[model samples]
Target: MEKVLLFFTAASALTAVSSLPARSFYFVYEPKNWTEAQSYCREKYTDLATIESMEDVDILDNMKDLSQMVYPSDSYRAWFGLYDDVSSWRWSMSDSDFYQHDEKEFRNWRPGQPDNYQGNESCSAMYSDGSWTDVGCSYSTRSVCFDVKGPNSTFVLVNTYMNWTEAQSYCREHHTDLASVRNEAENQKVKELIPSTGINWIGLYRDTWKWSDGSSSSFRYWRGLEPNDNMEHCAAIYFQDSGRWEDWNCDKKNAFICQNGFSQKVVKLKLINTSSVDLNDPQVLENLLKQLKQKLKDQGVDGDIRLSWKKQSDGNIFMKNTEDIGSDRDVP
Candidate 1:
């Protein structure tokens, strides 16, 4: 009863341990500007590192140890994923469903919209009749919610008046976040859901930081007096400054990090009762993926995994006109 397990051989012991697939960072020593570094990464590896959370930053910081040892003659300020977008309109919700086939870039704004009127109109809202406008985030208003990836493409219009931030919290808790109108069709649906009356908050906002690979991760890690919002500037991590992020001119050349492998895994599963819920809905597909991720973690797997649908060739999340089998694509 008192005996304890022991590792007889290092190789066998290493083989028995199961850890989540990690997004590893590779330090490239050659000097290149932001765009050139990105090209190099896409050609050889995956893409530029999209640091989503402190964990990602920590991983890069750990890699800094080896970077120091190997490239002592080089500068540690390397390029990551943050960049200055020519446009300021960004989605507040980071869900990938909005991204299927460049749908996220689709906009149904009224002419001269996102006017950033008064400089504080950072949040977006849609008129009950279907056009969108940017307004002050403090303005309280009703909001639309799309239960995408649910029983149906459920669009719920919450009548309670709340500011944009509060509306976001309410919608996220009840259904998904504030409605994300992907295209004209989806925008029409949202318009129909809300009365042809008051303004309703949607999931659009303005921000300068965007990912190189078109990811919408809103995570930011910056150093002292950083992100001065300089026009046309890009981001790089200063290794000497504790691996903190800094905004610099895009033309400045520096050695950078390349993340080559996908943090996602695609697994197909067959199921019954296909009519219970519309798995084709992005929100529903995302929720099911989350459940599967939790199930995996419950079985002693890593909890850092995120789940989403692996779109089919036709840019749909679920395979239609086929048996009820689906793919569980994990996001790191």
Candidate 2:
């Protein structure tokens, strides 16, 4: 015996169940200048999107129902985080760490691509699958968002002598914000990277008459003759020097200096006035003794402080000291 099962039911159920990729829908924002596009993506989705492969670029290239936002440029190409200028090759718009992102091959650049276009063009775009183009840094265009899963960041080392405002503008031109000191250790390290005579612009700027990091300008240590809002509006600290910070105008152009290393061993002390001396006599026995002790402390010493003194013709005395920590402050 054979049995046949038949159903006479028909609806649009199969047609309504259309197929879709697991991650297909990508949101497209309106065209914008490179800076604005970068800011928008960071605020909404992620840092400026970085396409890891030709396949990834192709995925974005295939989007159909594109719309515009922010700027009203009719240009079809949009900015992505890829550039090959020998001047500034890294992504200019992100503070996010780039070291962690899995390095991707540049498979989309045309043959002999990114020759830097007479050493000027430092920006890149994805025109279509297996196609990429370089554009001027200021050209406006739409930008894409990425569903970045891992850590994506960048580090900036500012080596300019500008007032805070000027430093910021410079960073913006390169698609980065002013440098921010995240911690006390980082601040110390920054100070050490600068010179003693000139101020190197860090992220700190003068908010009104007070020096400030964008987050907090109220709290700061101003160097002598600094926070000179009229002349200087930027700030920098010398390596291992214990004076403070200074402010300078952002526009004044000057060369900057920097150094990198592990946490600098610092020696902290309180200067106690044991005796009084005349204003003119900085090397008098009373003043000389106290000053020498302080100088020795600054050279990184505490217990069994030993120093050799030298008297100069200008009535100034300098001291050299050596120190070794031997357990307790009360031991000696």
Candidate 3:
């Protein structure tokens, strides 16, 4: 894939642009099954709410007030964002770019792994420097978290014992959930975070887990014994339990959580600034960004494409070296 650089016009570059709206979810109380509810949500708000992390789940958990005020129905149960397709195995980190490279798909599973032990082992764990093994989603274990803050990556070793869902919640609440080791370097970084004793949870699971909006989010909050029978095809947040997910009959409609859509398309473009000012200057760059944004809006590109400066390894927004971002120049 080639990197793109956009040409900025000096004549009409400083035009005003519309602001991006804050995404929000709405709970529809109409009595409908999972499929019907999904369709309804698609027709009205965004698709069935896609819970990205524990924080997303938290928003769904607190939707009761909104539901009562808006819906005013006495229904207790509802579907939020999970369903099983009985397809092939998939990662919890469903980002395609994360695995675009050949080495990023590396999986060092233990021998005889992913046996789907008892037909419900959908979660995974890693201990010491050992390979991974599939485990029941309900099993309690320590967890590893990955944080992509600025240029420095931080991995947190959470020793607290909790089921896969709880551990994911903890990770999202504190750091990014079970590290998505893109390559060997990331895998080793997360591996070092885990102590030698107990098994720790990693961001890996299978179940054809999908979001309502047809988005691929590799995060699953399934209970230990899940996807047991393909008969119970739809997924729901077991509010009665610990907010872990459970497979239920699609026809059994419960109060479902709806969330705003944050679907984004990443576009790599090569752009050129027509202005004579320094593009590296902070204020100057900001104005250039605004002009680019407005120009994109004028061309109907709009808020979907956000214009921002990329940070360097040393956490600087603008690199001191005059090397192309896609070049093979090494920075230390």
Clashing residue pairs for model 1: 46-260, 148-283, 148-284, 149-281, 149-283, 149-284
Global local distance difference test of model 3: 0.63
Tens-digit lDDT track of model 1 for 1-332 = 12212212111111111233666788886778899998998787778888888888878887764344334433668887778664667665554543676786888888887665533566889996798998888999898876767424567888999998888777767876677777888888888788778799988877656787655567887897776644436899987777889877787777788885445434444433325566556566555555556655775543245454555688765453353122221111
Prediction 2 TM-score vs. true: 0.21
The superposed Cα distance between candidate 3 and the true structure at residue 68, in angstroms, equals 7.0
- Choose the strongest candidate by lDDT: 1
Q: Rank order by lDDT, top first?
A: 1, 3, 2
Q: Ten-residue segment with the worst summed lDDT in candidate 2? A: 8-17
Per TM-score, the best of the predicted structures is 1
Question: Residue 91 CA error for candidate 3 (Å)?
Answer: 13
Per-residue lDDT tens digits for candidate 3, residues 107-183, read 77878775666557777788688578878889988888777544345778887799887776677667745566666
TM-score of each: 0.46, 0.21, 0.41
Candidate 2 Cα errors over 4 Å, as ranges: 1-25, 66-74, 84-117, 120-332
Q: Candidate 1 overall Cα lDDT vs. reference?
A: 0.68
Candidate 3 positional error at 18, Å: 13
Q: Name the lDDT of candidate 2.
A: 0.34
Residue-level error in angstroms, candidate 2, position 10: 64
1-332 per-residue lDDT for model 2 (tens digits):
12212111111001011222222223344434444544555455443444333454455545423333222322233444322213223332232332223332212344665554533343453342323345444444332212122442233444444433444455655533443333434344444444343323333211132111011112444455544433332333221233233443333322221111111111222122233433234344444345546744775533333333334477544222243321101100
Cα error of candidate 3 at position 192, Å: 42
